[model samples]
Target: MSRAPGQFTVVAPGRVNLIGEHTDYNDGFVLPQAIERGLRIAVCRRPGSRALLASDRGGPPLDIDLGAPLLAGRTDWGRYVAGVVAGFQRLGWTIPGFEARITADLPSGGGLSSSAALEVGIATVVETLAGQALDPVAKALLCQHAEHEFAGVPCGIMDQFAVTLARRDHALFIDCRSREVAHVPLGTEVAVLVIDSGVKHALGDGGYAARRRDCETAARLLGRKALRDVSSIEWPSLEHRLREQEGRRARHVITENDRVLAFKAAAEAGDWPAAGRLMRASHASLRDDFEVSCRELDLICDAVGRLDGVFGCRMTGGGFGGCAVALVDGPRASSIEALARTACAAALGHAPEVFLTTGVPGARVE
Candidate 1:
């Protein structure tokens, strides 16, 4: 594709949580990796102070006023773009009008964080045009704020951090409270399998917010700053003080945080079995305590977990519905995929979309 003098192309990958879920907002640890699938944007500067945005996915074109103080646009996806633009302006960058065309392979609502990809991709585009880069952590926080203020999702930082800082052949381990990061190597001996359940989840739909509220209430009752402050040792003593639902919510976060640390250690030691076991346990906690797993997700995890050569399987996202990720022996990935397809089809009356991916670099201009 030919481009104008100031034109640039930026790509941002989606992410799958390896162990941690819903813990970011509570200032806990999370392990996630950026997948090969993501959003691609071809963009260039335009003359006027308006953004002309188009998507290959068949949405009406969005025309956004860049000069306006409030840049939230009319469409759901447009809000992500506008939010990014607003973020750059907040940083005192003078943004001119731009035209962007977006194409994405990332599945939206599958809990793979397509929204973060869009936000980060657009942020990269702005940075590219300005010939400067924001500090990686600051850039990630900018995108996270966009999701909170514009998208109204009140998301944690895991998705944005994964999409912004992930390194190839590794998973990004983030301590959300401290903003410290380490890249855990994911060698080529295993494959990462993502199976989409075909059931979509929208976090804006109160379920996610309700869970966050529960955690906050739990923290308040325990007299802690956030759930992260409530250590596993303290959990047993404090669990009974909260209501039933709040107790469950606090239990999930406290334990899930511990699982993230254990999972990272297992990954570093190349102990696939231990890592897989942690994944399974993490899923169970999300289902029973966090209350996010759906029937389809549970079915996929159960079928895939039972297969030969599979280390473990679990639901990998926000969890009401989306995808399950499995770590399996690379040599047997194809056969496991086939068997998983047939088994899930027989039980659910249809086969799901399954694919394998490796960790890749985060958002950048190509």
Candidate 2:
């Protein structure tokens, strides 16, 4: 597709959860920040009921009809665009069908929320084209809805919220139940390192949903709205009544929420060591209790643990496989990354992809 004059470009960022994992759905707290890497969608209005979309990732240009029925099957990237368009329509905004060319620096399937970046970026484009401004919070919710209704992923609000509302130089402390945000500054000289284990996971593919179901079961058994309302002290009283897996799932959510709060306080106080300790503990709970971490993710985190100048490491996304985020000494970032690479390669027989990045501003039209 050729670039059109007057095309508006919007960039939306991917996020790395620093200390919270799988807690969003439980209505617990999460600490995440937008990364510099993200996706860009360039859009411009067209004359008819159809829109065209092309991507730098290489695929046939997608032709979509604004007034037509949803496609019968998943069309890869097309599903994301169609989902956003449908999202707007559901809001009673009849946006013009347009042409879009997507460009991205985010690593797809690395658990950095590349999908949320695409969804939020395109949602911004559609909202802009309609001459309507959406509140960031509402926009984030709509994007989450799009993923659930259109993309078939029962994702929580963390990814979309971070992509749309994160501020530069700070991590977002989100109360998933209240949808309240607090920007916590990292005052220490720590840098973020993301190591992609070359292992990919599609959360909608099943495991994620199963884990969610387990949580739901625990909540029902405990007579709570969600596990978020259940205290760690109250969990043991209900644990025996649940299946072993359900009990473990409940334990992870309750305990992880505690860690998120601890990490937030540590981050704000420039206490990197305490924050790191919580991060490592969070990963261990996810691995042993939640049963989400895969071998590759474990190897990457283990590699980081042995490296000096690294505060902590853990699998940062929905698990199964993705990236491990490490908080490292800013001045020794290079050496820590090199050590992590060598260790991961030795264990996995191939070097993992590593990115050294910083917190960046959230979505905006450029």
What C-alpha lDDT, on a 0 to 100 scale, does residue 68 get in candidate 2? Answer: 70
Model 1 bad stretches (over 4 Å): 1-4, 71-75
How high is each candidate's TM-score? 0.97, 0.95
lDDT of 1 by residue, 1-366 (tens): 666697888999999999999999999999999999999998989997888999988778989887777555445678888788889888888777889999999888999999999999999988887788999999999999999888888899999999999999999999999999999999877889999999999998989999999999889989989999989997888888999999999999999999999999998998999999999999999999999999999988898888888898999878789999999988888887888888778767798888889999999988
Residue 11, candidate 2: C-alpha displacement in angstroms: 1.1
Candidate 1 positional error at 87, Å: 1.1
lDDT of 1: 0.90
